[model samples]
Target chain A: MKSIKEINQKIREGNICVVTASEMKDLVSELGVEKAAKEVDVVTTGTFGAMCSSGVFMNFGHSDPPIRMQRVWLNDVEAYTGIAAVDAYLGVTQLSEKSEEYGGAHVIEELVRGKEVTLRAISKGTDCYPRKEIVTEISLEDINQAEMVNPRNAYQRYKAATNSSNQILRTYMGTLLPNFGNVSFAGCGEISPLNNDPDYRTIGVGTRIFLCGAKGYVIGEGSQHCPPYGTLMVKGNLKEMKPEFMRAAVFPGYGVTMYVGIGIPIPVLDAEMAKATAIRDEEIWTEIIDFGVARRERPVIKRVNYAELKSGKVEINGEEVRVSPLSSIYMAEKIMKELKRQIEAGEFFLSAPVERISKDCVLKPMRLKEVKLVRSVMTPAITVEPETSVEEASKIMIQKGINHIPVVKEGRLVGIITSWDVAKAVAMKKVGRVAEVMTRKVITTMPDEPVEIAARKMEKHDISALPVVDAKRRVVGMVTSEDLSKLLAR
Target chain B: MMLQLKFDPKTVKKPIISLATLEASALLNIIRASVGPREGELVVEVEEGKAEKVVEVLKSYGVEVHSIKKAVERDEEKCVHCGACISICPVEAIGFDDEKRVVVNTTKCIHCGSCVNVCPMKALALP
Candidate 1:
């Protein structure tokens, strides 16, 4: 076993041996976990992908009149100004009203690149700060402090996204092709920081990390952070971050998100740490979630490992579908290499966590939900007397925008006629009572029936409409393909 | 211009696309297609100059035809070589070059717009 102090001493003397997570897999196999742990002083890991729960807190210097800013907009992208008078949080996903493609993430990237950004704010008048409005350009140097406080930066594991339905789905996981033609996964399997330290043994509060190529610290567990698939909330100096490690993205139908590059170094304290860092892509499994559902609970098409994901294709629905990584493996590799070099040069040192992150937590989704029923969806049946003329029945169907009209006798359904029957009657010039064109054997349903069963009955009967009747056979309402489709689409 | 052709059970087995490609004397780039022996839809693209001939062949088959546009544009200045769009492109229209920079192939582009949505730089656009 080794202490973090010993590892720091070795790093200072240029005597430490550092290997990236990708390289450590082979190192562990060749030397075994015990020897590899004794030989290697540190293992560096990284991940680069679109992290939506990211933003920057900026302290814009007070204007000449000293305004207590209540509303703020940077480059037309609104920032939350409820924090303080001169401080606001620019969330990465906040889109610009002027141009949706431009967003808060772009502003953060610009600031990191040393580019100037336009700042505008409005405030309610107050005696301590009477200024009402202020507008100016501010760069990284002009701001008092620009700190990046991302609520969720690194994910230990994540599900890949795919579409099995006929229509293309534009989602946060990127655009999924129809019929499961493509799959996109975001987690960097072997070289990922959280994957290397699946358990929070070395990564926790106050643990230094590489955030967007800046020296940063893990502040706490992320918002959706949970056991078995932990995530981290990190903080860093925005001005010290590099543009290459940060980027702005817009997922078309989905809103804006920032691509964050995060790297963590693990000290080789014991053989367990070495074995954990050596975990290969083959052992890492993630679900291929069907994004086509467009719901809180998406269907899982299948489970696949990163090895199959990186090989370019995976078997989905008994067919080979191409797989892609929305997470930039290229950038992740570069970040890992940079972190390793920093440790080797003694420019970066590993630190013990001030406090370990909580492990007893589970992500809970919003509980508000609704289940549709046939009674609520069905419309009141439009009826016509059996002795009514065919032309009159057709006119009622046209005026009400309905295809089927139930012919009634004494306020009870006796038969049904559709637009097709009316057209046939007109084409044949068989002008007579509605009863002549109507079919007597009506397929009936009950109001309390589940929508699913009602829909299945229609499909099974190969019919478009069903009349809802009470116990005494009085027509109450009607359910049609149009109504069910409208409800399903929602 | 792009043309969508419906292939019914009778026409699905016929070589309609190949015939159109040969007689039109132009490359009819199939943008999107899902034709089965049962029945399906096929969307094809051709040079505007040769669209008339392609439309003529499609009409001769007595199939439904409609024009559509699904073109994706790339802005080189905004791209940072982050490679976010490389894997999401359904047609592999976007790929890495020798130096690991992303390159787009216009001919192979299916106009699916998958890459445009995944691009972190907003470098790719479906206009």
Candidate 2:
């Protein structure tokens, strides 16, 4: 194999023509590995998707009367303040205290757009660092340096998700339409950078890359670095397998996200690396996972190539299912093209990895120190007599600002009335007492019951509210969808 | 001439706009009119020399007339063939070919632009 220095000299002499990882596959076949490796100078690899493990570190320079930040927040989203007095790490999943939907990702996006973010921090004044608390606004430009340093980023390939249960599941896999309506997968499929280079030889610490429209580098192999696999043929060591055999994974939570780092090796030294760069989608394979099952090992329904997945249809257990990709192949291509343009314009260059990643690393399952469920937020049930008039019940509902009202006879829930029932009764011109219109059969939940059980009951029955009843069947409190939402947001 | 006519339901509640007052001076033949709950779109054909007259008639019924254009287009440069546009297509116009590249069949496209709206890569376009 030619040395990295020799490859650089060839690149400097303009003796090599750069090719993308996807393009190199065809070139290798056409020119043969030896000749193509000699001709090609560099290969560009890229990926683009949401990666939750990603976070950025910024030095906001000291504010006036600079406080030692013990607890920090950006735009109401908490940031880890354990580093120094003025620096902080903003995680992607950190949610804003003001609104759960507005998280650190949104804050980062806002900062990237050059918008100012409010910084809030509380500290115990020290002799050296005396300020106790500081609240200020700052922008990315105002920071001394803002760089994203994620331990794990690009994964080689990932499994697609589908639901087998009759009920709809809200997961990190997006909303799995009930009964396998559509499957969601993420990755660049063919043009992805890591998919192009299955082995870690070329991608490791100190490798310059394009990260989120900015220049970055590969610090090391990401977390959960699984063994590299290749096709059925040419199986020897980690680097010998076909690109399709490479697989890496991360934990699945409410939803799954991937981080992508597009890197271009400055110079291609040999045909072996050239062939690796030439991997195709037809050769890359990933498994289909049935997320419906709640177990440590989710069942594998099928193993398909990227080509079939990209076609939008795959037959699993003899049924055709539609597919959706969470990864942005368009953005990946755009970055690749942009990187190429930068290289051609002499504005971008590549650097060799200073240190290699340890392939011997293994992913360990996360062990919870302790799991506990505390009950403190169930909304108290507002009751109405079964003999109450529909108009009076409606008035009570409107006045109390509650959608559901429990109809009790002798302190015991006999039925339930919803605003929808009142609206429908009025529209149908059926004037009667609350009992006449209220649902006689009420699904009640116990206050001590697990929140998930209540949630599942609501989902199964397609109901929004449930009355909490005691052992004597007396109405105690209520758990509506709103209450559950408030509980989950915490 | 082929035109795309959009009927706004907010302006007129009558399911059939033609049931209302019709000047009828313009002789335009509607090839197909897909009326949905919120709005309706029609592909109309008019006599070679009576295109302007037909537009006037359509406009009288609050139908916004538009030119026949590419409803779905694939930006070949950006497409990574992830198949995100396939499931969202109201019409199965966009699908994978034997070569596995996502291709748009313009003839079968209804111009609903569902694929364009769902394409994460912004590789699909409608005009």
List the RMSD of every prediction in angstroms.
9.0, 9.8
> Model 1, clash count?
0
Clashing pairs in 2: A25-A278, A50-A258, A171-A254, A172-A254, A172-A255, A229-A245
Question: Where does model 1 sit among the CAPRI classes?
Answer: acceptable
lDDT of 2 by residue, A65-88 (tens): 778899999989899989999889
Share of native interface contacts recovered by each model: 0.45, 0.31
Counted clashes in each candidate structure: 0, 6
Cα error, candidate 2, residue A262 (Å): 2.4
